[model samples]
Target: MTCSEWADENFYLSAESAYIEGRWETAPFQVAILNSMGNDEIRVVNLIKSARVGYSQMLKAATGYQLQHKKRNGMILQPTDSAASSFMKAHVETAIRDVPVLKELAPWFGKKHRDNTLEAKKFSNQRQLWCLGGTAAKNYREKSLDFIIYDELAAFPEDVEKEGAPTFLGDKRLEGSAFPKSIRGSTPKIKGHCQIERAAQESETDFLMFVPCPHCGEYQSLKWGGKDAPFGIKWAENNPRDVWYLCEHNGCVIRQHELTPHFAKAQWRCHKTGITTVDGYEFLLNGQVSETPESVTWNIWTAYSPFTTWERIARDFLNTRDDQGKLKTFVNTTLGETWDDETGEKLEWENLYARRETYLPTIPEWAVYIAGSVDTQDDRLEIKIKAYGPGEESWLIGYKRLIGDPAGELIWQKLTEYVDQSFQHASGAKMSVGLICIDSGGHYTDEVYAWCRQDPMRRIPIKGASVYGKPVANFPRKRNRKGVYLTEVGTDNAKDIIYSRLAMQAKDLTKPIKGYMHLPMVEWADELYFKGLTAERKKLSFVKGRRVYRWECPSGVRNEPTDLEVYNLAAVRIAQQHFGLDLDRARPEGRKNQSTKKRKSVHQSSWL
Candidate 1:
C-alpha cells in the first residue's frame, strides 16, 4: 500500500493538525506527491507550499508508513535545535501517541524512555527515525539514511560552521542506500537563496494544484490577479464578504461557500502546459500508470485551504496592503510566495567613491552638526567622524584608525583625543563633536561605559539591535555591567537609510530635499576603508513566515566601517530627540570657547 493509503487506513489527525482527518482524497494532489516515494526511479520530492497546508504532517504520515511497511532508517532536519525540539513535542509526539499503529510499533516514545527520545525514535521494527537541527552539520556526518526530510530548507544557514552546506552533507548520508530518497519542503524566502525553489526548478515534472470550475468545467489554478487574469479574487467596494473568484474561462463568479466543494475535487496539473497529470482525476475517475525516472515537485497555496476562507483573505489584504510589515506577511503566508525587498540590492563602492568631494582637514559649508562613532576591534579601534546638515545630508569628514588592543587604556586615550578635538570648516568656524556613539558590544564594554559615563550628555554607548521595524534609536535599555544605560541602535534601519542614499547617483545630489552623502576624496581612497564601508549588502530573510530585511556580509569581510557609520547616524538622532541638540542652529554661547581651542588644535596637529 502507498504511504497516503496507509495514512488513510491507520493515521488519525490529532487536535494540533490543521486538517482534522487523514483522508488522501481530500488532498489528492498532496497524496500523489507523497505516493511518488513508492516509485523506485524517482529519488527526490520537493513540496514548496503555503503555511498550514499539511507539508510537515505529510512527512509524518510518510514516516509512519515507512516504519510499519518499508522499515527504513530516516532523519528530519529543522532550522534550529529549539525548532527541532518543538516539532518533536508538537508533531512527532502527538503522532506517536494518537496513531494506534505507531503507538504499538514505537512503544517506548517519551522522555527518559530508553527506546525513544526527543532526538530519535526507535521502532520495534528495528528502524530508527532521527530528528536533528541543521545548524550543526557534524551530527549529519556519521548517519546513513534511506530517507531524509528537510523542513524549511530556506531557513537553514547558508553554511554549517566549516562543515559545508547542509544539503550536500545530507546527500552524503544517502550514499550507502541502494535507492536513496529525500524530500525538501519550505514556504520559500528570497528568490536566489530559496533552497526549495531551486530544487523545484531542477525537478523534471513540476506540478500545480488545479480545481475544475464548477460552472464551466474548466481547470484553473488560483492566482493573485492583476488587470488580466483567468482566476483571481475580486471584491466589492470596502466589503470583504462580497469577495468572489473570477473564472477566466467562463467568467463565472464563484462565491466563498462554493470553493470548498471544488477544493475537494482538485487535481495536479503540469505548470507549463496546464495539462492534468495521469493522477489528476483519480478521485473522480480511475488511476492511470505512467513510467519515468524524473523527480517531482508540487506547489500549492492557501486558496485551496478549507480553514481559510476567501473573505478572511480579502479582509487581511485590505488591512495590510499599505503597511510593509503586514504586507510582507500577507505575501509570504497567504500568497505562499517570497517578498522581494527593493532595498536588498548590493551597492558598488566605486559608484559611491565617484561622488567624493575634495579632501580637507575641515567640514564643508553645508555641515551643521558633528558626530563620531567608534568600532571596537581586538587589534584596533576604528573611528568615523561625520558632519550632518539639514535633511540629514551628511559628509564623511574624517576616518581615523588607532592601532592597539581595544581592551588597553592606550587605545581609549587615542579615541578620546580624536573625539575631544574639533575640525575647522571652510567658513572658518570650528565644530567640536556634538555627539559620539561607541560600540558597547565588544570586549571593551567596560572601557566604552567609562567613556560614556564621563560625559553622559554627549558621549553615549550603544549596542546594535536587529529586531525588525525598530526605530533609528530605541529608548535606552537596562544598565550594563558598569551601571550605565546603553542605547539600542537600530542597525537595520540605519542600513536601509544608508543604502537608499548610496543608491543616489552623482547627478541626483543636486536635487533638493534628498539625503546626500558626501565622501572625502583622500579618506575614501584607502582600499581598507573602501572595503569596510561597502562590506555588507542588504538581503531578504524569512523569520517565522515573515519577511525580514537584514545586512549580510561574506565571511572574512571587515564591516567595521559600516557599523561605525550606523552608530554615527543613530547618535545624531538620539541627540536631536533626547538632548534637544540642533545641528542646523548656531552653537550655544556656553560652548563657544571650547570650539576656539578645538580649532587651534586642528591647525597645530601634525596630521593636519
Candidate 2:
C-alpha cells in the first residue's frame, strides 16, 4: 500500500495535537514527501515547508506507518528532550491508545512493559522506535536505526558542544542499516542560514508542485503575482476581500474554491531531478522566488492544503508587510519561504541599476557640494564621490578603483589627481571635492593617516564604531598617538539613515523623493557596483540578552560599495561639524556678482 493509504487506515489524530481530530488522510501535495520516506531510491527526503500544513501529523503518520507496515526501527528527533516527551504524549502514545493496530504493534496499555517507555518503544519483532532530542550529543550514542525523522530540522542545535551539526551525528545512527532513509522538514527562517534549505539544495531531488487551472484544463505552475503579472494571485488596492488568483495558462479568474479539487491532480516536478519544464515554462516553485512575493510565479497550489486559502495568505501579507521582523515570520510560516532581512528594507541592485540617470562626470543641476569616501583594501582602494543638494538629496557622481597597494605612493598620487580633477555643474559652475574620508580600518592605517594629515580640514581619517545608538559623527577631543585627528563613525546609525532612504527606491519609484540616491549611467556604475552596495543585510540577533542589529555581508561578497557609502555619509557629518557646510540651506546657483554673468569657481572653499 502507498504511504498515504496506510496513513488513512492506521493513523488517528489526537484532539490535543490536531485541529480536526479523526482518521489522518495525507494531502495530495504531502503524499510525495511522505512516500519518499519509504522509497529506497530516495535515501534522504527534505521538506522545506510552511506552518499549518499538517507536517507534524505526517511525522506521526510516518512513524505509525513504518512501525506497522514496514516494521522498521526508527528515531523521531526533535529540538529538545521536553519536545520529544511531549510528542510521545500528544502524538505517538495517543496513536497507540486510539488505534487498535498501533496498540497491538507497540502495547502501551495497562501492561507494565519496561521496553515501552517514554523515549523507546521496542516491538515484539525486535524492532525499536526511539524518540530523542537532537540537542544533546549523548542522545546519539550507539543507536542503530532504519529510518530517522528530523522534525523542525532548522530548530535543532547547530552543534552539540563541538561534536558537529546534529544532522551529521544523526545520520551516523542509521549507518548500520542497508536501506537507511531520512526525512528532514521545517519552516525555513533567515535567508542563507536555513538548515532545511541547505539540506534541500544538497538532496538528490528538490520537488516543486504544479496544479492545473480548472477553467483552461491546462496544467500550469501557480504563481503569486502582482496585477501586472501574466497570472497569479492579484488583489485590488491591497484589499484582502478582493483577492483572487488568475490562472497562468488561461488567465481565468480562479477563486479559492475553484482550485480545491484540482489540487489533488497536482504533480511534483523538479528541474534538478531532470524533469525540466511543463509547456515550455521553466520548472519553477513559488517559495523559491525572491523575498518579494511578486518576483516570479506564485504557487497558490502551495497554499493547497484544506486549512489555508489564497485570501488568507494575502491578508497575512497585508498585515505583516510593514514590519520587518513580523514580515520575516509571515514569509517563513505563511509563505513557506526564507526571509531576506533586506527584502523590503533595502533597495535591490537591479532596481537601482534600472533607475540610473544619464548624468555622469558632471554633477546634477541641483547638486550643492561634494564629498569623497575611500575604502582601503589589500590590493585596491575603492572610491566613491557623491554630491548633495538641498534636503540631503544625494547623487553618485563618480566611482573609481585605484588598483594598487595603499602602502605605495603611486596609487595615492593617482587618487590625488582624481580628487583634484574638477566636475562641472549644469549652471556653468565648477565643483571640487569638499571633504574626503579615508578609512583607517585596513592594513595601511598609518598610510591612511599620513594621507589625511596632508590637509587636516579637507582630508580626515575615520574609524567605524559599531556600538548601537552612537551618533553618526562623533569627533574626538584630540588626535590619536599618530598625531592625526581620527573620527569615530557610527556605522549602525548611518545605515539606518541610508536604509530608510533606500526603502523608498526598492523597485519602482518614478519621481525623486527626499534623500533619494541617484546613480550615473556609466561603466563604473555596473551590476558589480550595485551588488556591492546592496550586499549587506541587516540581521537582528540577541547578544547578552539584548536585541542587537548588525549588518551581515556574507563571506566573499564584496561590501566595499556599502563601506564607501557609509564613509561618505560620515564625511557629510564631519563636514557639518568642522566646516560651515549646510545641506538643507543650499547656496543658490548664481554667485552674488553684480556683473550678471555666471562665473565658475574652480577652487572649492573650506573642503579637504
Candidate 3:
C-alpha cells in the first residue's frame, strides 16, 4: 500500500499535537512529498518548508510507514535532548496511543518497560525504532539503521562535541543497510549557513508544487508577480484586499476563494520543459532546467500552504521591501528562497539632489502609510518622516532637527506631538505615523528608553548592532535596566537593502517601482540633505584574511539622514510584524483592519 494510502486508512491525529484532529488524510499538495519518503528508488529525501505546512505530520506518517508497513529499524533525531523529548510527547506518543494500527504494532509495553523509553521504541515485529538526542555523538553510535529522519535539521548543532557534522555521523550509521535512506527537513535560516538549503542543493532533483491555471488548464508554478513577473499572482497598487492571480497561460482573474484546495488541482514539477525523475533531475535557471544529473536525492518545497494566500504574501512583500531582515524572513519562510546580502551601490549627492520633485509637505498620491525615525544627540534630536506606498515606493516628506537638551522632557514631548500629528495624502485621506524608531544608543539612552517605554507600540527604542546578517527588526525581549524593551536594529543588514533600493532610482517619476525613493524640493531637504544621505559609501576591508563589507562615512561628515532612514525602515518593519502594518491595506486613520477572512465565491477552478 502507498504511504499516503496507509495513513488515510489507519492514521488518526491526536487532539494534543494537531490543530485539525481526525482521520489522517494526505493533502493534495502533500501527496508527492509524503510518497517520496516511501518511494524505494529515492534513497534520500529532503524538504525545505515553512510553518503550518504539515511537515511534522508528514514525518509522523513516514515513521509509521517505516515501522508498521516495511518492518524496518529506523531512527528519528531532533536538534537537542529537550526538543527530542518534546517531539516524543507531542507527536510520537499521541500517534501510538490514538491510532489503532500503531497501537497494536506499538512496543511501548514490555517487562520492566525497557522497550517503551524515550530513547528507543522496540516494535513487536522484531524491528526497533530508535529515538536519539541531537547533541551527543554517542546517541548516533549504537544505531545501525536502514533509514534516519533528521527533524528540524537546521536546529541541530553543526558539530556534535567536535565529532563532525551530525548528518555525517548519521550517514555513517546507514552503511550497513543495502537500501540505506535518509530524510532531512527544515524551514531554513540564513544563506551560506543553512543546513537544509545545503542538503537540498546537493539533491539531484528540486520539485516545486505547480497548480493548473483555472482558465487555460495549463500547469504553472505560482509566482509573486510585479513588473518582472507579469502573470501568476497580481494585486492592486493601493488595496491587497482585492487581490487575485492571473493565469500564466491565459489572463484569467482567479479570486482568492477560487484557489481553495490548491492541492486538488496541483502537481509537482521540477523542470521548466520536461518531466521529473527523483534519482536524477535538473534545476531551472533563468527559465530553463539544466542537464539531468544522477544522484539519490529529492528536494521538495511546500510553497503553497492550505491557508496561505497570494494577497497575504503580496502585502508582506510590499510591507517589508524597505526592511532587509523582515524581507529576508519573507524570502526564507514564504518564498522558500535563501537570502543573499548584496549592498554595494555608489551614491552621488549631485544625482540625488537633482532628482528632487516639486512637492511641499503634502504626502504623495501614492503613499498609503507613514513612518518616522529619530537620531538622538547630546544637544539635539534629528527626526525624518517618510511616507510609503504600494511595493514600498516612498517619499521623504519631512526632516527636522529640534535643538535642545535631549535629557529634558521638552524635546521628547515635542517629538511625541510631531509624530502624533496627521498628514494629508493627496487622495484627501489622513495618516498618523504608523511607527517611530528612536536611536537609544547615544548619551540620552535613559530618556529615549523611558519615552519609548511609555508607548512601545508606536514609540520604539532602537539600538544599532551593525551585525552582518541580522534582521532589521527583532523583539528579542531584551529589556533595559529600567524595564523597557530595546529593539536591536541590524544597521548593516538594513543598509544592504537600502542601498540596493536606492540604486534603483526610477528615471520616469510617474512609474511606481518597488524600493524606489522620492525626495521633495522643500527647505527641510535642502543643500545638506543629499550630502548627508549619500555620505556613507560601502568600503571593503579584510578582517582576519576574510573580505568584509562596511558602510563608512568621511571622518567629519554627518550621515544622520541615512541613519534616520534605517531607523525609519526598521520602524515600518516593526509596525508590519507586530502591529499588522500592511502597506497595501494597513491604514492609521479612517481605514479599518482589512478582514483576512476568505470571502465566499464560486469555486471556478473545478471543471465537471
Cα lDDT for residue 133, model 2? 88
Candidate 2: residue pairs that collide: 222-298, 223-298, 224-298, 458-608
Model 3, 1-608: lDDT tens per residue? 87788788878888998997888787776676777677665678888877667888989998988888887889999988888888887888888888777788765543358778877788788888877787999889977798899998887888899999888899888888876778898878766677887887777666776676666677777665553455755667677777777777777888766665554866556553345532222333445655433233333332366656666766776776556577667666776655544334457788888878885566766676788999998899999998887667788888899999998999989988888787875555566777788998888888888888887656778887855668988865456677666788999888887877777757566655778888888777877978898888765432321235678788999999989999989988876677665665422232223222211111011110
What does the lDDT come to for candidate 1?
Answer: 0.74
RMSD of each: 15.0, 16.7, 20.5
TM-score of 1: 0.57
- Per-candidate Cα lDDT values, in order, are 0.74, 0.74, 0.73
Candidate number achieving the greatest TM-score relative to the actual structure:
2
Per-residue CA lDDT of model 1 for 82-124, tens digit only, reads: 8888888888888888888888886675557777777888888
How big is the positional error of residue 189 in model 1, measured in Å on the Cα after superposition?
1.7
Collision count of model 1: 1
For candidate 1, the per-residue lDDT at 104 reads: 82
